[model samples]
Target chain A: AQSVTQLDSHVSVSEGTPVLLRCNYSSSYSPSLFWYVQHPNKGLQLLLKYTSAATLVKGINGFEAEFKKSETSFHLTKPSAHMSDAAEYFCVVSALNYGGATNKLIFGTGTLLAVQP
Target chain B: EPEVTQTPSHQVTQMGQEVILRCVPISNHLYFYWYRQILGQKVEFLVSFYNNEISEKSEIFDDQFSVERPDGSNFTLKIRSTKLEDSAMYFCASRGQFFQETQYFGPGTRLLVL
Candidate 1:
């Protein structure tokens, strides 16, 4: 079984400060990791994905995350946080099925980030 | 950029009534999926469709749930009997014809069962 755990339920950060949202996973195989952001009243948007290509993946809007195989962690980070960066983030893990037909994502509970102006 | 779209941004219904949530996936996409998120809960996968049939489904997608691609472009999820527990934000997603592609999500439809 594969699962993702987002460490913080709520994180408050000041504008222009560094931002970090911790996420850990338990996977049975070499998994595909992804970070998705859901803005208020908006659909989910993909931040970044790691598909066995690069350990360090860059995403839109100055967001990036590193896949650490040793620690089983894929933590999202940004050099500076903006007011618009406030939103809900989810860590997802995709494991291939038994038949290897297709892969499905298992999402984390989610972390809500609040940016102070 | 192409994206998935869903119908009925929100719906309110009584228990035992049937509801059909509709979605129009990206024009060239081949895989379709349905997911739901209860209030203050994690998003869960319900079912996945390909080639006009169900390729895989989760435990939550039981006999009461059915999916169909009625036309070339529309994919639908029908709930036979709505329950209070069924209330959630339903999201439709689609992926294109490629290996290890990213799934694009819809704005989501909020379903409230009373």
Candidate 2:
């Protein structure tokens, strides 16, 4: 089974400051990792994903994440935080079933990002 | 770009009543999924549908829940008897058959069971 843990439940950053959200995962096999962001009352939107293609993945809205295999971490980062970036972020892990069925996704509890203007 | 769409942004139902949440996935996507998130809780997977049948499901998808693709365009999640615990925001997602493709999500339906 695959699981994810977000190190922070809430993170506050001032506008124009750098932002960092930590996440870690546990998977027996090779895994696919993703970062998703949800605005207030809105559905989840994919930020980026690491499918073993690249260690550093750049996503929309000037966000990026680096998949570090040795540390089992996939942390999201942004050079500058914007007030509009205030939202909840989730780290997800996906692993193919040993039985050859479809893959299953495990989500982290979520981290709430608050940007102060 | 194509996107997934869901119906009834919010719904309220009495206990034991049956409710159906509807979604229209991206036209060309071949995989569909349903996930739910309780207030202040992590999102949980309910089921995955492909090739007109359920390909995978989580323990949360019990006997009370069923999924149907009544037409080529619409996918539905039916709760046989809704309980108060069933209240949550249900999301529908779809993705193409390609490897490691991102799943596109719908706006979601907030089901409130009274």
TM-score of chain A of each: 0.96, 0.96
What is candidate 2's TM-score against the reference? 0.98
- Residue A29, model 1: Cα distance from true site in angstroms: 1.6
| Candidate 2: regions farther than 4 A off | none
Q: For candidate 1, give fnat to 2 decimals.
A: 0.66
lDDT of 1 by residue, B32-108 (tens): 99999999999999998888788889999999999999989999999999999999999999988775899999999
Estimate the lDDT of model 2. Answer: 0.93
List model 2 lDDT by residue over B1-114, tens digit each: 888999999999999999999999999998899999999999999999989999889999999999999989999999999999999999999988875888889999999999
Just chain B of model 1: what TM-score? 0.98
The superposed Cα distance between candidate 2 and the true structure at residue B65, in angstroms, equals: 0.3
The alpha-carbon lDDT assigned to residue B56 of candidate 2 equals 89
Native-referenced DockQ of model 1 = 0.75
Q: Is the docking of candidate 1 incorrect, acceptable, medium or high quality?
A: medium
Instruction: Give the alpha carbon lDDT tens digit for every residue of A24-113 in model 2.
Output: 999887789999999999999999999998899999999999999899999999999999999999999976855544565678999999
